[model samples]
Target: MMWKIQLFKLNFDHRERDAVLETVDSGWLTMGERILGFEAAFGDYLGHGARCTAVSNGTAALHMALLALDVGQGDEVIIPALTFVADANAVRMVGARPVLADCASRSDWNVSAESIARKITPRTKAVIVVHYAGFPCDMPAIAALCRERGLKLVEDVAHAPGASIAGQMCGTFGDVGCFSFFSNKNLSIGEGGMVVACDGNLSQRLRYLRSHGMTTLTLDRHKGRAATYDVAEPGLNYRMDEIRAAIGLVQLDKLPAGNLRRKELTERYRRNLAGSPLQMPFDNLSADVVSAYHILPVLLPQACDRMGVIEMLKTAGVQSSIHYLPFSGFTAYREYFTAQDAPLAEEICSRELTMPLYPTMSDREVDLVTGALLGAVA
Candidate 1:
């Protein structure tokens, strides 16, 4: 059988179209009812009574969160070297220095709390923790550390939309939890994001910042009872469109079912790959940590070349990818941290390979991928 599986694919059906059409027929296209609805629903999902502010993308959400916290020049933000470059780039955008920290081997792909402690300086204003590949980081420990040091905590929850640690939702654990609803995320809106804030004051500030620092959003000003507005502060155009928000609302409804399917598929992948040399992601230390299984990443033994394995898998029609290259390894970050400082990140990057795992993937597809992986390693 000829297989044409992809690394990731968006799951869209008539539900998304109906939602979008409803917004279009209403003749309101910008941020409006759909956006507010999604924000409220997302807050309810997180269980923290947090205020959610929708934005254009995850990067914008991160940027706005940092700005809301007054993080800027002369400030330092600690982040895991294992995360995507966007995590660090957001810090740089705010004129704050991104202090890269190493991750722990035993804890999967999360930055070590000890490593974070080592890098903290008096200039450290915040710590950004990434829940890599849907695996929840040690948030309680990291949160405690931040509280002890008087540092704000920002969560890069791009890959962990439905994840929780110790019964606490991923986004609620931190002061500001940033999420991406990109096409590939667990719950997607094509190109949208949301920031959940613990503080009402901070949430209000973010609401203004996402709408070009306006005292009120376009919906607020034009829809009802508003005629004039003022620019409270300089902000960016990061508002989420009604169309995307409409799709997101539908996607949100299906998230629970989709996540359950992902979990089942993940268990099957683990069972099929058992007794093989490939290293699977570790189970959460606590029962409360429920992952949505965004990607099924396996660590190949050092004896096998990572890129070589990826190429071989491609030849076999099994799509594969690296979850991320260490942020510190990128040329842009080289100016800040040396390559030698992130040894764990380097090792993980060299061995990491993300295999296909989506709700649409079939049993045959999973078998083909595992078979190809086994052959490549052997």
Candidate 2:
């Protein structure tokens, strides 16, 4: 269906088109120099000598991270109950159990060190913290806790790319940081992701894992860099294509300015909905924290007619969505279906509503969305 104000609009320009066209004309598609270039540019942006490996998508990044970290059968990985399903899905893929950790509270919306500690056990191998709605989690405390317990930390940075805390990039804070370049993310590239590690060994393992565990790349063989190769271990075809990599480079250049615009727009939405029934989550962040402002998610009042509000939004040509439903409540996770462990998460998930938020979205659109929501609630 068409929308006068859809969920998100691409921040594309002639540069993206030109990049795509040039990459197509070069005829060296499929994880070639463009992928390397994208990786290098991204690593430079990440800084602190981060070893960046671009992957097929966000899920692939998550899978590769878990695999590289050796989080497999009989191990338990702690994940936020309120995050996207991909986290639990990735953990499940590796034959590990997903221990659902409740959100910090109605305001933070992210899994905190306290919540994570409560869920830890003898089998717990890793803890994956999602910076929900692109707000930085209390990473310093989380990192300290992980270090104390000898557990691995993986960051689901799909919602946060340029976000940082304590002068360190979000992805760099953990052992393995995974970023998504999905169409709706802060860095929009349609279908791509990056996995970064501060450890050289882990980075090398991730690099090999992304390309079917081969010792050498096809691009290297094509360029006669290596005459023979060996399969170090079995891996997947999670290599990103050239087109998306080229597009990602362009997106990277535009990220900072775009994030600032999103920050401005986020404040606009807050002002517009000041007296509305909906309550915004993830506020009162640290002064050192820098958010990418990837998406805008607000909480509707309990017992309110959320579905009716959504339908009313549709009539006004506005589109909205739920950021997520708790993974525990899904049929796929029946064994782990108890919400008792993550009552806060279940409570927040029930009322969480994701409104339209994108860099290109205008103040007028923000007002329109808020106005429609207010009318629907009233």
Candidate 3:
């Protein structure tokens, strides 16, 4: 059903359209100069002299990072059970088992270092930490734990592109950081992603693995730089097209301001929902960390009727959603894992509800949502 307020919406304008048109007018739609420009600009935005490789999507970026880190069969990668399914699917795609970890309480919905430590074993090769709902995980402790265990770190920064910990960007703290530009993301480009790493060799591997392991790109041949190319190794055709790259460039420029707006709106949610039954995350977070504000998730009371609240909100012309269920709760994953261990994650999943929090939403809309929520939970 269509609600008065959608959970998320694209905020594109003439600039995005113009960028796509320019790419079309250039008559080169495949991976080429535009993609290179997007990668360079993304790297600059991420700071810390990051090296980036634009991929087809966030899933491809995760797969490539795993491949670059040499994670394969018989290896186990620890990840939060509270994230989108793509993270776990990527681990399985690489022939690795995803050792799901429980998130902390609602105040901190991200997986903690203690949960990660509990999941580690002799076969554990890496840890894929997801910055859930744009909030940066405890990078200092998580990074230190990774170092102590000699494990590769892959950060799934799909929700927290602009988020930082201690002034350093979220993606910069890990061995390889992945991002998504899906239509719902803060920096949406319909379908696109990027991977970043400080190590030049790892960056090179990511670049090579994105395009069938080609020794030279088609752009090189088009620009008369190379007449022929050689294949280096087996790789997937996970290259972003020039059209998406053009859109990405425009979206990148708007990200910082968009994130700021999201932060402002988040404050509004907190203020409006004050004394309400819903529990908000990141309320007592550290000063050094800043969230990307991609989502606004709240936990309903355990005894509250979740589906009844959703229906009531719908009747009141508001749209609400669930962030996710623990991966082990799904039938596909249930056979492989158990939910008994992830008590907090499972509990939070049952009560978590995502409300509308986009850049273009208005104060009246926020008031409507909060009013409807209060009435629903009453």
Candidate 3 worst ten-residue window by lDDT: 334-343
Q: How accurate is candidate 2 locally (lDDT)?
A: 0.92
lDDT of each: 0.87, 0.92, 0.91
Off by over 4 Å in 3: none
Q: Rank the candidate models, highest TM-score first.
A: 2, 3, 1
- Measured by C-alpha RMSD in angstroms, how accurate is candidate 2? 0.9
Model 3, span 1-378: residue lDDT tens: 777888888889999999988889989999999899999998888899799999999999999999999999999999998889998899999999988888866688898888899999999999999999999999999999999999999999999999998889989999999999999999999999999999999998898899999999888998999999988888889999999999999989999999999999988999988888788898987888889999999899879999999999889878889999777767778776777867788888889899999888888888888888888998
Please identify model 1 stretches exceeding 4 Å from their true place: 1-3
Scored by lDDT, model 1 comes in at 0.87
Clashing residue pairs, backbone N/CA/C < 3 A, model 2: none
Clashes, model 2: 0
Clashing pairs for predicted structure model 3, backbone only: none
